[model samples]
Target: MTRSPIITVSRGRFSSTATQVLEQVRTARLASRDEIAAATGLSIATVGRTAALLVERGLLRERPDLARPGVTGRPGVPVEIDADGYLVIGVHIGRRIATVALGDLTGRVLASTTVRRPLGADPDLVQLSREAATLLGSCPGRVPLAAGLVAPWREIDLLPREREAELHDLTGLPARTGDHISAVAAAEFLHRRQGRSEAGGLTLYLYARDTFGWSVAVDRGVQTDVTRAASLTHFPTGADVPCSCGRTGCLAAAVDVLPDAARARILGATAGSVRDMLSPDQVVLVGQAFTGDPALRDVIVEAYAASTALADPVPVSFTRFGSDIQAISACTVALGPVLDDPLACVELTGVAAACRRPVA
Candidate 1:
């Protein structure tokens, strides 16, 4: 089945009242409209209207059954995210494997399947889309609104937009594409937001594995414009390691940190450089380079501490997701539209035609 071209959701758009109410309800899991209004600093009337609209769109559901027994007003009824009502597809095209996953409205990965690709081969969009459709079919009652695709390496022959179009056409779902690193950062940010209150400031995310890269997140949003050339691969670490680009001491050349002190030093120096440049409130270390070996992680940490110029030390921590980072990041990209603008996403996905349809 053919699908309309998916319009890119503007990540730079300011949060709306509906978005605020939805986010408040999502974070609270279940909350009264009054609670949402209070948390979001929105008027009660605005919160009520936004909540009602979200409920109508199937993004949220009112739980009158859980209403306070003594209360006789709308304030007694609580609203919660309708996680089972919708699903989004997340496709991560890694260097060695391509993963397709199903995510709920709450960014939970419901199911996933991975396919291995030959070394340095272009991904088969048709095959990947078929796999995604199969996974979607396996979930009997969920309405899939959109798909998010992420890749570690960009193919010059096929742009990300073209790939998104192909996936959308094949799967009949709106699709968005982005760099895997940025998606990973976004996933981390969203995860932190969901878990606890985030400290106010910038977060610098460092990724090391087959490639070296970094992303910055301001408050609740991640910078999504990371390019391969802009990666930390070219960052000088003052090491003697040779890089494919005819450079010495490139970060990419130090990926093989199998207890090699030199490579570890390179990684540490790069992290320190990032620390000094951004002076982020927090630094998140992710990917196999840091998680694969404890010794390497220690070296990087030590180097980062020694390299920092700030009077106060910045907090540095490893990602809790570890190897599952890629999948979660892709899912975050898919759920972006719904979370950013639920009402618009519901309308764009034609929720009335499918979201409300009964499961067979």
Candidate 2:
């Protein structure tokens, strides 16, 4: 068994053997005190006192069936975290809509609402942010401690920072956005969950809406915690299809379907689009393109096929969970914090060798 090494918890908040045990039992699901002590390299007495204090804080619990008699060769008790401790908000800002979901530490959606809005930071961006932020305004009697906002794919680099503070400030619930990709997180999380091991298959996620992103993960029979991926919307994939990015022939350059003019009318594109990118196997495609139109789905597949890089790998196909993947992806990112330990309850694992291949 791969023994999870005990590590320090809350570096400045509460640093001790107890805090370590608290974090582990709550997240890793270690069953007993001996298990905790062995993992921490701490003495049994310290483990006991620390556990007692945690029980008083409503942070830990002991299993009755696992409880043992006094030196009678009986089964011992197992302890775990009491999960009903806090609340968190997972906000997914999509091109056309924003989904806000309230969850516990275990990823349970206490309440959720999906709202649609215009795009960009001007009046639209401000409205989107204001509406997205309102989900937290109506607290569901739970602790309104933190909210995680997952903007559309390209905005990953737009999160305010030291220098970017001049860009704009996002307030309410210690929120900050960065280069964290939802496709990447979902892929890795799935690889760990279903594969039964650390390394196995690959996971490919394509956000196939107004704005798009792609991610791939591979495990050479070993589960991968890291991935090689990109959110590729910087330029047009084809030469003539219009895009929302205010350019022609960017991603809007090709058409296996209608004429570029016709596609532009339907796609509401800013550039001429062509089939440029291809996804690896078990590729999970999100958005209405797949569900609403069969021909559009075929076009997506064929467009992928036309590209040597995207078509050659022969990956399995997966679909997005909700209407907007960003919503669930946002859930995946934000919900992790609410649970005592997310891995125990949620099946965030995936198959082996997810997206590994020689890009054709």
Candidate 3:
């Protein structure tokens, strides 16, 4: 049976007090230092220090009204995660357009801008570099200090160290883009942000919008070898599907065949056609096609039924997410810095967790 993933983000593997505090804040939507201490067993001192640091990082905010009673202990300002204070930039690079988004730390997008740059003719890197720069430069929010980018990368036998550096440089945050922040090195970040352990299944995360991207997480954390388990761009229908690589029939090759393009106003036709093809149990369609267009939902439902007719049906139904598959895919690569195996993380974090989960 397939498994659908549930995402819950917390500072990974925190101490007992921190975990308790996080749960309170996540559920109650507001917390104060003393309140946190009273509710979670964290000492007021530790809570104060941690809360201060998180606030400095823009992860939380102070809520002054929910004051503590002074008779019992000291009164302190209330605190809540600054859901609106900071943002994560998600850039979806595709053959036809690019997507730039400003998301709060919780991964909720507050504002976004999409630019269409006909990319089939440009050198993929030069074009991608320009797009990444453009998105970071133009997106609107609280004047972001750091940018998180997602883009598709060219497939290779081996990737160079310089390529990694170039990606960081593209963000225009040169000093901040080094080892700790680069995609390949931040597995812990993505792993923690992705929150897939409880999903209990083997999954494939296809980052196929601006670029071909992916990540996989199973019941196990980083300790096992899920690399061998991921199928990259095409899983069940690899060479069999028509794709841009000039392959007669590749999984995404038929993306251009959607009939409802005009109605959906989606970037292109691939998404609609794919919807006509397979329907995983839980799909998380990102970008314009899925996010902005509603009729496309029907197209996806029909496509899903058609997908089942194949000789070997995908084992489970799926939820949906993806619009600029290529951009999401590329982000998967930029995302590689964080994973031991970038593709594996895609499987775990993306939709596969909702499709077929590994038995715990």
For every model shown, the clashing-pair count is 0, 69, 83
| Whole-model lDDT per candidate | 0.74, 0.45, 0.39
Comparing 2 with 3 on lDDT, the higher-scoring candidate is: 2
The local lDDT score (0 to 100) that residue 69 gets in candidate 1 is: 74
Ranking of predictions according to lDDT: 1, 2, 3
Top-scoring candidate (TM-score): 1
Using TM-score as the yardstick, the better of models 1 and 2 is 1
**Residues forming the 10-long window of minimal summed lDDT in candidate 2:** 3-12
Model 1 pairs whose backbones collide: none
- Name the weakest run of 10 consecutive residues (lDDT summed) in model 3: 175-184
**How many residue pairs in model 2 have overlapping backbones?**
69
| Shift of residue 141 alpha carbon in model 1, Å | 0.7
The TM-score obtained by model 3 is: 0.50
| Residue lDDT tens for model 2, 126-216 | 4544654566566543443345555543453343233113213443343323223553245234423431322335555544455545555
User: Each candidate's TM vs. the true structure?
Assistant: 0.85, 0.55, 0.50
Cα displacement (angstroms), candidate 1, residue 146, comes to 0.8
